[model samples]
Target: MSTSASQQADLDPASFRAIADLAYRESGLTLVQEKSSMIQSRLRHRLRDLGLADFAAYCSLVQSDAGQGERRNLISALTTNVSHFFRESHHFDVLRAELDRHLPKLRAGGQLRIWSAGCSNGQEALSAAMTLLDHVPDVARLDLRILATDIDPEVVQFARKATYPERLVRGISPDMLKKYFDQTTEAGHEPSYIAKPVLTDVIRVNELNLLSPWPMRKRFDIIFCRNVVIYFDQRTQEKLWPSFLNALAPDGVLLLGHSERIAEPERYGFTCTGPTTYRPCHALKSTARPEKQKQSEG
Candidate 1:
């Protein structure tokens, strides 16, 4: 075949629609018409990997029963994994407040659990671990655990590795960077840091699809489902609210990304405690609020 004949064209409209439909059905990801070009850009490698000529063939496989496993690959390719160490400092403040209220329980061998849903690359879960250790130096010996889950297995594996190159380590302060991570350098390569075992010990990295029923039996004390559901459409977002509401313990706090919010959260069993922060409607007004501090990057 000539070079021009062999070259793949842009994702055709039918192929985009088929892929979009599969993504929505399997993972609740919304792939709109306007984003077709971007979606194609992301999935082109899948075509190359399968030795396919175009998106159409790729789409065909993913929609079939035989493509069940490939559906996960499609979702992984489409899902966004952008994250930072202390992306929003206030959430850690909330963690500190919760630790204050819940530390006594932990000391008594009671449980305190935090869930970092969509924990792209481990920073969020690691940040929560840092906050916990800062509060109780021997927290790893206690009943506290951080459950970090993502739909993408690739990012889950990365989170498990708990290593970051310099670029990915941007949001961490030098003190925190030193305290939590150990720097490893190789010849002619940028220094990379990995989370010390103490930091990762309390963190349980798992592959979880938020759309699937949660396997965890224990309700969480704080749930950080941040910057995750923004890709989901309104109906999909609403569907997740009830699960989160049910997943939280009484007086439990739920924190969303600054860019995400639930309309009429009260109707969904949540009280607006702060911007994108919530408490169960049945909880006391002051459930997890320790003291208000002006937010700052740490």
Candidate 2:
């Protein structure tokens, strides 16, 4: 169908706003007026699946109390989850370097925690696991684990399954692929690879909504929330900076998308150490600010 036909025949402004508001409230995803056409395009599948005639009916259902269960479907349709193994290579290099420095401490029975917030389809978390395994072969035996989470439960389940098609595994080196994944071909399906127990054993997949309160009790030594914040507005993004800071252990590292940066690092008690990489100010004693100063600076 043509774009004009879809927009004019399906959704009106009121219905689009309703969806945008729901998305923002539930998932912190900012769907502004400019996204009206895109929103209509994305939600067409839902309308077809439900046998709805237009966006007005879809909106009525989603906004009513009876449509609570459909909200998840709405989010799944609207949110994009384009990711791949080693999507951002430099972050892995930095992780490897950090692990090298922390090797002595890890060997001394110290605990290490890494959180892959907004971990879509488990690539980011799995990449971290691969890096750790490459640097510290004994990571599995140590008190180390990667917490991979995404708001989409379906993707979380997919991550737990640890299987990917040949296309998705293209960037992974053959040596690493051979070491970490096992080839499998179903009777009628295309050839696929599944992560071996050695790799999957050290990672935990969870379905979590970042907008909601975090349930974990421990702080993370490293956090990978790359590219996920782009969907949120600046205000929503600002609110998350403090939460991420508080969740990170002192001296912990926070890795962001290539285009994402902490707007005011000093205010959040973070200092840029590398491109899209930050460390808590407390980690740098010399640069630590007084509580009063920090408050005033923010």
Best candidate per lDDT, number? 1
Instruction: Kindly list the per-residue Cα lDDT of model 1 for residues 1-298, writing each as its tens digit.
Output: 2333324557998898888888888888899999987887788777777777777778788888999888889999999899998889988877887888887888898999999999999999999998888877888899888999999999999999998999998888898889989999878878899999999888999999999999999999999999998989999999999999999999898889988888877778877777678788888555545235422211
* Superposed Cα deviation of residue 189, candidate 2 (Å): 1.7
Clashing pairs in 1: none
The TM-score that candidate 2 achieves is 0.91
Model 2 steric clash pairs: none
Give me the displacement of residue 267 in model 1, in angstroms: 1.1
| lDDT against true structure, model 2 | 0.85
- Considering every candidate listed, which one attains the maximal TM-score? 1
Q: Which stretches of candidate 1 lie over 4 Å from their true place?
A: 1-7, 186-189, 285-298
The lDDT for every candidate, in the order shown, is 0.86, 0.85
In Å, residue 282's CA in model 1 sits off its true spot by 0.6
Candidate 2 error regions (>4 Å)? 1-9, 286-298
Report clashes for each candidate as comma-separated counts: 0, 0
